[model samples]
Target: MANALRTFDADVGSAPMDMLSALFEARGWQCDVHSTEEISGKVKGSWATYQLRCIWRREDNVLQLLCLPDIRVSPEKRAPATDLLALVNEQMWLGHFELWSDGGMLLFRHAAMLGDEGLLSLTQAQALVETAIEECDRFYPAFQFVLWSDKSPKDALTSAMVDAAGEA
Candidate 1:
């Protein structure tokens, strides 16, 4: 695939957001360019299809990505979900999970600061999306266990950590 990110110079006002949209289009993600500063899409994972949103803050030179699984934590379950997030975030090398208190929506969030140059490579964008999705996939079952099955955060995390040696 061509690096859509490389096509634009910094002089282009919306270069970062434009390159982001092109990269998503090239990868055939269900991309929506909400505005010059935002893009949203869906990504299929082993456990679920995640909703992805990317927002570019020109003033701060920050590019933020949010990945959300198709699950909601009821008010009663938010405390346990919060525990699970703490456990889950502790182990991650990239994005961290967040539980929106008012709405009880769980999501993975990561942001990159582009500095004054305000440049992002396609590879960096890919990594940001992939890392969010991957971490969501890896921890999805734990969230299920906590929210639905009433497992303790530690136990749910333990259950989710088990890896099958090989496909049958």
Candidate 2:
């Protein structure tokens, strides 16, 4: 069968890292942090570039931290932009909390129903993408977390961009 199409986007700032770390730690999620130049790759002529990613995962859910620097900001501007960092911090805190709550609810509802193999299937994958989109949308207006959910891995990558943009 052909692969299903996917899409999503979100940009948030930096303050949520510690909160996320704490929350996930309490839940026993394994957290891994890495630094890289870029997190996404483009197709032959695509304009989109991938963002750096920090991933937190447990048995059920995955939380991502994305670092995106402003394309408009040049290397010549060496000093960190305080305004950008503050914006990112606000959005990440709100967005991550919303995602956490929604993911928890979905996992609670579907855990037994999905089981192990079912949870690993395309249907479950789609549900996860959808849940993230829905939760993020519900919380976006309140916290200014801007993102697009296209139901693609690209969307997930974009989320990291939102996260990274905060720190950048």
Candidate 3:
């Protein structure tokens, strides 16, 4: 078996990080371009405010994204948080949730291999940001339940998955 050929141009290597910065600014999010390889920003979501960061690795041709929700899991709650993350990660397709060992901060992380040419489209960048925010919003309540309300991982996941039909 053989892999399909992916096309790329020399200029493709230079545009991704800039494009990402522009996209973030266009969305009115607070965007900061920290050198040519990284950008960080803040976005407001329904359930919580989020910190979003993107790092472009030129040598590896990879783009890494991290989205952190406002909620933080205390050290004591890290056990249940880990359980909840495991269950949540199993249900994810594009990205997975992780509890950082340093501060027990929960975040959604995804990385894309842009191939040898390192081409990244604006649409791809937009999708990455949107997906992270959407997933975090969907699962925020479950984290709250497990960390704050002392709910079991299964029960918290169930509560978070329930879709409310309409506004009261």
RMSD (Å) of each candidate, 1 decimal: 3.2, 16.7, 6.9
Candidate scoring better on TM-score of 2 and 3: 3
Best by TM-score: 1
TM-score of 1: 0.88
What's the count of clashing pairs in each model shown? 0, 26, 0
Alpha-carbon deviation at 145 in model 2, angstroms? 9.9
lDDT of all the models against the reference? 0.83, 0.30, 0.82
Candidate 2 C-alpha lDDT tens digits along 22-136? 3334334344433221112111111222122334343433444332221232332212222323333454422333122222211101111333322223333334333433433
Model 1, 1-168: lDDT tens per residue?
A: 556545654344345677778777777788889898899998888899999999999899999999999789998888889888999999998779998876788999999987797877666777788899888988998999998899999999988887421323
TM-score of 3: 0.88
> 90-116, model 3: which lDDT tens digit per residue?
889999999888877899999999888
How well does model 2 score by local distance difference test? 0.30
Which candidate tops lDDT? Answer: 1
Clashing pairs in 3: none
- Every model's TM-score: 0.88, 0.25, 0.88
